[model samples]
Target: MPARDGDEPSFAVAADRSQWRYRPRRAFWRSRIVRAVALVTLLALCALVILALVREQTGTEGFLVGLGLAVLPVPLLMAAFRWLDRVEPGPWKNLLFAFAWGAFAAALVAILANSFAVRWIATATADPGSADDLGATVIAPVVEETAKAAAVLLLFLFRRRDFRSLVDGVVIAGFTATGFAFTENILYLGNAFGEDQDLGDGGIGAVTAGTFFVRVVMSPFAHPLFTVLTGIGFGLAALAPRGKRLRRVLLPVAGLLLSMGVHALWNGSATFGGPLAFYAVYAMFMVPAFGLLTWLAVWSRQRELRTIAGVLPAYAAAGWLSPEEPLALSSMRARRTARAVASRTYGKAGARAVGEYESFATTLAFLRERARRGTVPVPDFAAREQELLHHLWERRATASPALSYAARATGRVWVPPQYLDYGGYNPYKG
Candidate 1:
């Protein structure tokens, strides 16, 4: 049946079941929950395998020591990324998957590939020294960056909606790199401990201390910094118009290449000019680059807020939202205040509903803006916008009052219209 005057538009085509040529033999496996469970199980298996391999190489005591030390920076890095994503946070499941993919699958691939390449170079060239140098400066960078990038690419491809913005790419990539760094640190620290034991040092050995200082204390952000370049590329690609396929493909490749070059340069610093070169690169290049990227990520986050504020007024004018909602939603402080007011008045459920409303509103703004720009396909945009609007409508009872109060409290100063009853006003219809 065709849509009626009061009905939302239907973008989906109706298909006849009798006309199907083929159907899945195992329909149960096609469910999203089933696919998710399978993916998680696979990642867990990879983690177990990698853990076993590392333990075998490092020994039990070394593995334990490495595990303890390597965990120090994980929480800090994860927290920093999570903080950056506060404006429009992606689902935690996506973050978790990225981390697991990095920690297990990507790390495992890097280890196997690097080790194989190094061994092959050693045998073919009859020079252990050359193999070690080549692996560090060439093979390791290419392999590890590519391996880590796989996770980012997978998320970008499979979770396109959640992976919409630059901040989303950065956060997802950061989590993946954090996991990769954590696993890599474990291996490096564990090996250093093993070497220390070989020297019969009863206490804290020089090798172990040096590795810990470098990997944990000094340059814990090293891996994440490298991968974030690739993420920036994907984020930019996500913003590209749908017709610009070449730009989309080239952006990510350019980012991956840049990541590989930087990784190689950092690795080769020690070989080029010894300790002075390494420190010089760290002080001059690494520190400044990290600072620049940090600024960019934060600026992008603020830009998202500005975008929301700019685009949402149209929806408000259309009666999809209260007049004061866009202003209140754009300010992070106001958003928080709104949630707090809901929590105080209606307890946890109200707070949760308010949070959902905020998310839906922000998402709707983004979708509509993209639609206007022709970046998102029309049908997909229509369906997603309608879905988000419906969600916002459902929670408006709890969310609107809180947001209106927030707007007034934050100085936006909305007065109730004399013609409409403020308490019972129906602000939206789907």
Candidate 2:
């Protein structure tokens, strides 16, 4: 064995295989830790919910009534949030946590703070009548919106990779806002029902029922829609060039003020004898505003899709991605089809890798844009960018075999003609 001069080294092959084994073991442990933390957090939130439901003397019937009212609108609202998030899907666990944080932690804190603030303000002003309005309109909107928005801000701080676009931020913020609204509605509904029970057979019950119907049906969008504006600001700020720190701060502040203004106006209009004024204001101002934002969101999403098409040719020529993959990536429908092909050819893991790679590419693009804008600090920018790229490369490497097989089975070899011109081709040339 020692006399073999041209033999390949066995130790090198063994080391390479060992490195591969080490990676999966590390990944397994990391996943286990993440799951453990997620489970613990969820259990704690559930315990809080149980405590909130049981602390009242209303017993099981009362709790059920309250829960019923609270849970009713959740599905519809969740669907709406999902629609908003269609542009860039995020982690479900993070979204759920954001909502729960608002429902439990934010709601509890806001109630306490708003109550204390109203009492202090009322005493100082020597006006008990003003205290009720203070809590409902001024203090409540400011404190509650801020609390709900904090959930999104914390997400950006902790999980930047998960939030690839403004839509992701909006959806996450909307979820938090919805959670706050749901819990608040429950309290209002329960109080109304309880008050009705005390008043006699028909009177209080009818009024409470009417209130619940209006809050649940007509104005379910109130809190979430309002807070989504702030989410837009926060999300945009997060994307701003690191150099424009002032803009980041000011933009979100402006958004918060806008949210407060809308909330205050809504509260003010509700105090009127007729809902006509509220309807009129909503028609004249709020509807138009929301429509404009929706249009902007769609336009922005289209631009992002175009960006992938523009940048991905380089990778296609490098053999990392097929030219056809970029086109498919631009369309959600096509992306789904690609995943189906992957799943059929390989398995769930192949499909999942496709999704992960797509997400990684989107995040990388956002980071690159941020870096170009000087929003990312120069010192750490290169390292972070490289890390993101490396992750994308690794994901592609894992999925390539499956994707190649899938492409062959489907009789579709997606070669990008434009890939030849990616590095240096003059568009002006014939």
Candidate 3:
């Protein structure tokens, strides 16, 4: 029999009821056990750190003071990097872990390896007394840069998509460098504190405070800024056309050379009485170079926005968006506005879905650009594009009901069935 007017189809109603009834629940005890294990592991690591620090030093006061001083500059430097990462921000947890790896794991390895290399080189050259200078100028730069840069390289290996541009690379690289600098500073500050203890408390406190001021305040950017240049090189290398393997290799090599040279110059100039020469070199060379590179990043991001805007017109015409909506989609402001509409209509869950859809769109744009430039293999590109499209559809479906309601209330339809079809939103028949 034919379905009656204003009456729901029996099969459609049954399917909707089944969907509502389908809820997958996990065993509560299993989840609790996993959380318990993770908590224990974290506690174990903390215990190990405390044990190691206690065994290595005579007094806790100097170490605590050093740790306090060392941690102060990290947040400020991280904020600066965050400002630079506006175009493509990384996952905060991943970024923080990278920083921790650089500060603790890399710092420990670098100090050991650098010390060993310096000793070996000095002995081989019959210049035992020159070990400290060699370590500072040559060994330290090579070891520390490699160690800190390793954090960024690891990020590339694991989370390649997070590294969309030079600024993204610089942010990760800077955080890693900041981590290394923090740990190293703690050691130096702790030693200074201990040394000061031999003198009167006033004298010790004054000297320690002065050293902290000069190191942490006057030149906090020294290490992170140096490493960020190399990161820019790595990011460019990652985005270079696939066939230009040699160019990719050369870019990072040149960047590393630039990093080492800057580091050596910084150390060399510090040996002099004043920073006049260092300041001149930085102002004349480093500042202009970094400034130009930063300008290029901003220009590239703007170009990306224009490219996305140009390409999206076809979808807009197909009813996926209004003509004006495409213009809005080209800006983060508009994206945020859309998210707000989703939230007000459907609550936080709908807002989250909207955000995910936006993220998927951004990823799709990046991948498409890479494919167009031949940076990604053409054969695999289609599959990746489809995967991103599927995710976009799922997120859009979650946000769609609210969006449709909003459109109706305002008498300004933004997305209709034709839009859904254009966006590949195929409903599950099962």
Candidate 4:
């Protein structure tokens, strides 16, 4: 018999009822573990090889100095990215993988490929200086940006659920670039320290201090800035309707090209126009671009909060959530106060439940928005929606009261009888 217009797909209906249980596919049992292990091993191998190569080039004392100084900015950078992702944090595992890939796999590839290309150019033209110049201005940017973009591409493909938003793209790309910069800094600083040692000027006036000031102080965000353009491209693609294959493909490619172009320009600044030109470009172009992207990321985060406030009221009306959850969840201040209240009331367990509740609800909001926009196919929508709702329901015992209290405490009073249309989203309807 043909299904009616409003009928739920039978499989999706079944998925909702199977909420308390999870059954992984047989392939997950067989292939996924093996694949994960293989990837880890490969990353580890790359890390070891790169460590040996860098150490050999920099020598022990220089490597030690570089390692110590190079680590200073990593924690701060990671924290900034993590803060931007507070609305819908990707799994830590994904961020870890991305960072590792950048530090090891991407760095290794860039070094080896750049070295090979520069050598070839030098041999072909019999001009090591020209080859070095070309490598910095052209080959390095293309190789490095593509290498960093590989990790972003991997996450966008395999971790589609977490990679849906523009902020998500920015965060992931930022971490990857951060890791790459960390490794690259180690090399450059290590080499500078070696030069300082050779010149018997290992103090304030040394080359190491100048290198540190340039790489660490002045332009720490350089790699991240270049790569995030590619991420924005992927993120925009993610928001596109699934049927628009050409848009998805083209957006990311366009982003990659843009990233490569900017990277090349930045690299060529020193070669083409000298120190004054470099500073001019940095002040005129790089700073403005950074400010613009930073604003975009923050604006997108607020928009996400508004979306949650707007969309989740339908769920509240249907009794999946309390009347005040939408309002409370939308405000970060309320969200924090709610967690504090939870902690005071029932200790860490209560706080944990509220935190999980917050995460699940945010994810649910994004999932619904995507579904409504046709970015998520209908067949998959039912299952995912059910899963998120199930998690939310499980934590409601603790989360609901905290959220309600937060609503009141933070002046987020809920006025009811709105958002009731369901917008084709009522899963409980048979």
lDDT of 4 by residue, 1-430 (tens): 1122233323433354434223345465466778889889999999999888899999988888899989999999999989999988899989999899999999999999999999999999999999999999999999999999999999999888779988888999999999999999999999999998888884524689989998999999899999999989998998999899999999999999999999999989978889999999899999999999999989989999999999999898877788899999999999999999999999999999999999999988998999999998786787677777767767887998899989988889943444454775655555
**Cα lDDT for residue 218, candidate 1:** 83
Candidates in order, TM-scores: namely: 0.89, 0.76, 0.75, 0.91
lDDT of candidate model 3 versus the reference: 0.69
Q: If the candidates were sorted by their lDDT against the true structure, best first, what order would they fall in?
A: 4, 1, 2, 3
The models' CA-based lDDT, in order, is 0.88, 0.70, 0.69, 0.89
lDDT of 2 by residue, 1-430 (tens): 1111233223321234334422345575468588658756864775486347543634445455666877889998888778666545777988888888777777877777887998998899999777877677688888888888788887877676576567776788889988888778767776677667777755347757887877887778788878888888887877776677798788778888888888877777765425898778777876787778768667767777777666655556654466565555656665666678678866898789877777766666666666666766665555554554555565665454444444444445554554366568745457
- Cα deviation of 128, candidate 4, in Å: 1.1
Kindly indicate the candidate among 3 and 4 with the higher lDDT.
Answer: 4
lDDT of 2: 0.70
lDDT of 3 by residue, 234-284 (tens): 888888888998988887778777888888777766554257876776677
Instruction: Report residue 143 deviation for candidate 1 (angstroms).
Output: 0.3
Residue-wise C-alpha lDDT for candidate 1, range 1-430, written one tens digit per residue = 2111234433232133332222224467686779898999999999999999999999999999999999999999999999999989999999999999999999999999999999999999999999999999999999999999999999899888788888988998899999999999889999999999999998559999999998888898899999999999999999988899999999999999999999999999976679999999999999999999999999999999999999999888777778889999999999999999999999999999999999989988888888887788887776566667666766887998899899988877756445665567645422
Clash pairs detected, candidate 4: none
